[model samples]
Target chain A: MIEFRHVSKIYGKVKALDDVTFTVGAGSVTGFLGPNGAGKSTALRILVGLARPSSGSATVLGLPYAETACPGLRVGTLLDAGAQHPGRTGREVLTLGAMTLGLPRTRVGEVLDLVGLTERESRRTFGGYSLGMRQRLGIAHALLGAPEVLVLDEPANGLDPQGIRWMRRLLRDLAEAGCAVLLSSHLLHEVEQVADHIVMIGRGRVLAQGTADELSRGRGLEETFLELTAHTDRSPGATASPGAGAGRGSA
Target chain B: MTRAGHHLNDIAGAAPSPITKDEKMNADTPIPFRRLLAVEARKLVDTRSGKIIAVVMVALVVASVVARGAVVGPKLQTLVGTAGIALGTLLPVLGILTVTGEWAHRTALTTFVLEPRRHRVLAAKCLPPLLAAVALSLFAIVVAVPATAVVSEVRNMAANWEVQPLGLLGWTGGNVLVAAAGLALGALLLNAPAAIVINFSTPVLWAVVGRLGSAGAALAEWLDLNTTATPLMRGDMTWSEGARLAASVVFWIVIPMAAGLVRVLREEVT
Candidate 1:
């Protein structure tokens, strides 16, 4: 249960997000797809209360995410897998999160196990972990509190093939169990394979959104995505133009 | 499915873990302040930089006391006062590190994500260093007691154990004020190198300004914490001296800390 209502974020001359709106219902996986600088990360940041929106609002479970009691337990998020302190052991990082959320210490062990990090690996400092290990640790941290909703950004960035498949199954399983999952990624094909619904964005505007089959038609999701985003110029100062919000990549 | 996926499938495919589902349905309670304090306090000594600073604090205290014993025969007041040198000078650096470390390490995102109330987080961050100042002041006294006995016995001098409780309180209070100044500056800047440099450099600047004339010297009495704090550490104060100390504390600790709190609360953690 996540909703973005007419949300717009402007930083100086750049409109990072413009009248963007979307939703991910309970027991569903909504893949938020966009190119670089497409405002995906900016929108997620606003949703999690890291960055304030210039207009409108975003809410989770009927309340702004920051206002919800024990938000860490109600809504889990992994905006940047590398946001952890490098000097801390993976276990220590998770333990602190557990402490912050008032969760049992065993939850740390369970999530560490769920994310496929071994006890030995968990004991090692985060600075020494590989990028894939960081992603796992981040995922473990997101799941540590048993949240009802997950807002993840590029969760599969450093994962191997196996790790990717495991993540797909985990998201699917979480959705099956009635967790709302909003996943953002650049991997169009992976989004096609796992996402129950798709929202395509380009240049801070929603380009298209529907079930995979409906949006892809017969041409497949990748070609449709490229065709939709290709007409929008991806540059820093392009947001000020009158025609920047052209619908569906109209040239 | 990959090998890891197969292993996790048993847990994943079997629907949500019972614990997770149960907890999700359980009552929504806010994070307790005690837990936040414990977490913030643990973060202080958890890093390599944090450990290095701590070890340096201990070493400086020991070195100062032993050197005092060698040079001045370890009088009780001097021994205790000398041992506080490390705490007064460097404990604030520790305070600076605790605040700036969150920004330097990029853990602010994670911290804010878990607990979005920035003011609550700031409040939690502020208390640990003040507590450390009190603890370390006592620790310095603890280390000085043994050093006084051992050093006096080695050099064939009697150890003086007579020091006023008021004097000890003054010493600890001054150290706490200095540490609070450090915390305030760190929060104001949110950068370790910048805050630490500014924290150390302001006193030197004040020393130079104090040499300008009677006006500069008078200004320093109200602005330079080092000058105003002397009477405080000596356990003697007139009403005028107390007022001056209060003025300097406001200039050094209160103003910066209040401004820093506003900045921290309004800051966007991107």
Candidate 2:
């Protein structure tokens, strides 16, 4: 289980997460939804112990994420697919991660096979990998220790239809086996299909949180999302009146 | 029926009793820090750059022995020391490469993710290079010995091989310190070229500054680079000179290393 308690983050004068609080329960997939410039990535970074909150704290399995015993064993995270060594082969990269976690060496090959990259494991360098391939490798790396909690940010960014289906199934399977899965994506339909719970944010604040059905209500998921965030202008000086611009020009 | 019953009884007696649930739950397994270090060391050794550095050091050692034996006329010991100086130049370069490789390749994230304890990762990175420097220096001596002997035989000159064991030990220690200092500088600068240049040029810069006047010369002497410190390791320095050499090592190597460690801990890994 992952818990965020009254977490707040600031980047200079701008607030990245404003007094946010939420829980990701075990045996379920929670989709983190936010429009561009929202606190989705910041929140995820804090959860994984990469970025600290300006106030409050984040915990994984009741212990602070940074202070947990064997954090790699408890939580697996993929913040970005491109955040890896370009020179290392897929197998080498996974092996390094496994070694650090005190896992068996054979786990490296197992993860490669699990992610369907066994064939290209030795031949593919991270720098040369396709976006889809890198995504798969990232997921494989995150699963290295069979972690109980998995956190992924923008996991399906470059995936095709087939890869997307594979990712959805993998995430569901992980959750079904009693792992807490927190995934962030901009695609509403994808989240609607795969997420059991949703946390929606706009302008660095949680606007809504519940099951997809509850959040969407009677409207289409996309329409409901639009309705929730439509009035929340991301820009600081955005105006609601269309005729205001014309009136100002005439003046 | 009796025989079958006896056989069944024997089989049941042979089977071991199962462990109690409480005992199984209470069993404790300790984390293996030593094993983790070994694994990290193995990973570093298995890399392409690691192998290249090892091979190049060996080759340089051999070449140095041969060139010195053939041309320097039985001043084999001095020649080996000269070779040590040349090999010393590569030590800092290797250190720079090791640290910068993490950032250049984006592996620092993977490394930090697994260990999470940044200090342990830094320690692991430093250990291999220090060990390698010592091993390479000793190997250089071994190579120098045989080559000197052969050259002595071929040239028909009396080979005065002054094997100063303490001096050799001191030189090896100095080399290890130099490598560690390099690694620390690499961490501080976090750039290969900049760190290497700064470390390589410090002694020279001190020497140039020292040559300006009496005060400058005294300061330069005090700021001995590995080059000036080389004579001390050979036991050729006076008491005052030896103290000055030790001070130089501390200033040039120790201080920079501490600063680098601070930077590494505080700075964001880019």
TM-score of each: 0.93, 0.86
lDDT of 1 by residue, B1-270 (tens): 355345444654222454555655432777778888999998888777678887888888888988887888857789879877778789778889888888988899999999998888888988998998898888888888888888789999888888988888999999999999999999899999999999889888998889989999899878898889888888997899999999999988899989988988888886
Q: Alpha-carbon error at B69 in model 2, in Å? A: 2.4
Instruction: Tell me the tens digit of each residue's lDDT in model 2 across B211-261.
Output: 889988887777766655666567566777778877777776778767777
- Model 2 CA lDDT for position A110: 63
lDDT of 1 by residue, A1-251 (tens): 89999999898999888899899999899999887778999999999999889998999999998888789888889998888788889999999988888767877888887889999999999999998999999988888777779999989889999999989988987777678999998678778778999999877999899999999889877667877776665754544342442332322
Error of 1 at B136 (Å): 0.7
In candidate 1, position B221 carries an lDDT of: 72
The lDDT, on a scale of 0 to 1, for candidate 2 is 0.73
Report how far residue B69 has shifted in candidate 1, in Å: 1.4
The candidate that wins on TM-score is: 1
